[model samples]
Target: MANEVTTAPQDTRKPAFWYGLPVGYMSLDLLPPAERLMEIINQLRGLPEQERDEADRALRLYAGIISLLNTNRVQECALGVHPDDAGGFTTSVFTVSTLPTSGSAKLVVAGLAGSAADGPDEGMRPLELPCGVGFLAEKRSPAPRSSRHPERSDAASSHIWQGTVAVAAPSTPELIVLQMVTPDLDSADDYRNILLGIARTLTFTDPARAMAADEDREPEAPTGASAAMRNDFG
Candidate 1:
């Protein structure tokens, strides 16, 4: 059981890549980017003056990075902040992009692996996600190699951690690739678990129809206002 890959109950619906946000993660609006940026800036109004200034600068820089990704076919980006016991914070980034051509899931995995197999990192393995069978891999920062002396490589004291997952979009020729990066390797297992949860939320169903289904399942509220009038007095 320990060696098996745990997954969520299958959701047999959708023709689009609609996924749910994981806890502590905020999704950025990609439909014209600026709309979401303004929303985030407004939320910083409650912070201390100095902290707010610092956060503003950082947010602008991050927003620029997202803009560059949008030019490519990246559909979504999310940021997660987790508080630690040591009174500090750890952060992670997640992005989803659709591949250019249509192909089977096996072909998609092969293409992803062929491109990164040369990188120095842990090996890739089969991952059983709710969407379907997929592949997962962890990548580490490469040590800087000398340009003049290609034979000699500089040893790096530390490196960053990144995780990638590739799953095919159901009923479509598209393939979706998910990538996550974090500075803290100590919590790699926990981060991986979060990635698994996010992957399970993926579906190829139409967002409009899926949302309508959810509304249909919701319980109806009390009809009359007279039965529910409790405002500091019975």
Candidate 2:
């Protein structure tokens, strides 16, 4: 069990966008049960607006939904990291989505679609995987992802198969969003790691590239993570 996070570095050349976080939130209306999407929006609305005095608001970015239809399967979930509570103002969230490497979050996410067959009570849990502890894995590719267990151990704790969603400009041909339900997740960072994995899983069809692919698309106009989401996602 390692807790190191790794991001792929470009070949001395940066993409238009960081490939870490997206320009803003995305909608999965193309496919879904409808209600599921609504749940995501409510979750975002539920987030406390006021900054807590105790916990250091280390997080600068967070992903949330404005409103979406519910669905049987997760078509998409508004995903992003945190820089500040405000919707826009910082590009930090973009960094998380654009991460060149997969990091622990991406590995877990890419493996999820395959792991879904083992019933619903197994594998990485929402709050556990992204927030879990592990060493970061580097890659020869431009973007590298960290391995979850790398070592032999007691499997993962994700309730649903999850992965990091590559943060690409909404303009991409297709995009993915994901979220999880677990008792352990308690902070924006926790959500970021898990969501990042979901994004990671979507980057490449090939397992290797899939693991390293971060933001596969280009960046959109700068509107900050949250603010851009409010307008784009809706």
Candidate 3:
């Protein structure tokens, strides 16, 4: 069995594999999720005072809701915010989970496809990931209860975009699932592409094996040494 961890190139302490999330995504997996979120929010600079205040309250609510929903199976989660180009922010929630048990990749895809087909507008299709085979499921639906505005009765009419990717572990029966949710339906295509790009970076491998492979790679010889070695060999 391999341990799952998302890491950056500069941080070797967290090993195994890392998701290449683009800029503007703030990780919330650190201890005390709310504090981590606040720290990230406070680090942001140059926003108007009122806008910054509103973002603070919104993120606090978002973090609170997320903390309640996250389960033990969730390996990683992050919140991404980007300019909507309409003076407001487009927010996204991204999570990666290890499913309980599934026989194989094919079975998992079949199961997902069956369920996805039942939804009126949901669609599922096969996807070839860099690490393994998987499927992509997408659907559009009314915003969740938490997403609705408290003061607006018509807020429920708003729609959200949900994209999910399920990839099988290379050497295990486990399925690594990545899901992204955003209420910015206008940018659905862009979000779908972002989700697919992140899915391709998912890999399942033992830390020890990955480190050993790096060590086994051939080192480049110095320029002069390479010529001398070539002449000597000739």
Residue 59, model 1: lDDT of 80
Q: Give per-residue CA lDDT, model 2, range 89-140, as digits (tens).
A: 2221211322223344445444453354443643333322222222222111
Considering TM-score, where higher is better, how would the candidates rank from best to worst? 3, 1, 2
- In angstroms, give how far residue 174 of model 3 lies from its true place: 2.1
Instruction: Give lDDT for model 1.
Output: 0.63
Which of candidates 2 and 3 is the stronger one according to TM-score?
Answer: 3
Q: Residues 67-178, candidate 1, lDDT per residue (tens digit)?
A: 7876765666778899986899888887887765555766776666655555554557667765577778877775345576665543432556788888865655656778
lDDT of each candidate versus the true structure: 0.63, 0.32, 0.65
- Most TM-score-accurate candidate: 3
Candidate 3's residue-wise lDDT over 75-118, tens digit each?
Answer: 66788898887898888988776664647755776676566556
Residue range with the least summed lDDT across 10 consecutive positions in model 2: 135-144
- Stretches of model 2 off by over 4 angstroms after superposition: 1-8, 16-112, 117-234
**Candidate 3: deviation at residue 57, Å?**
12
Whichever of 1 and 3 has more lDDT, that candidate is 3
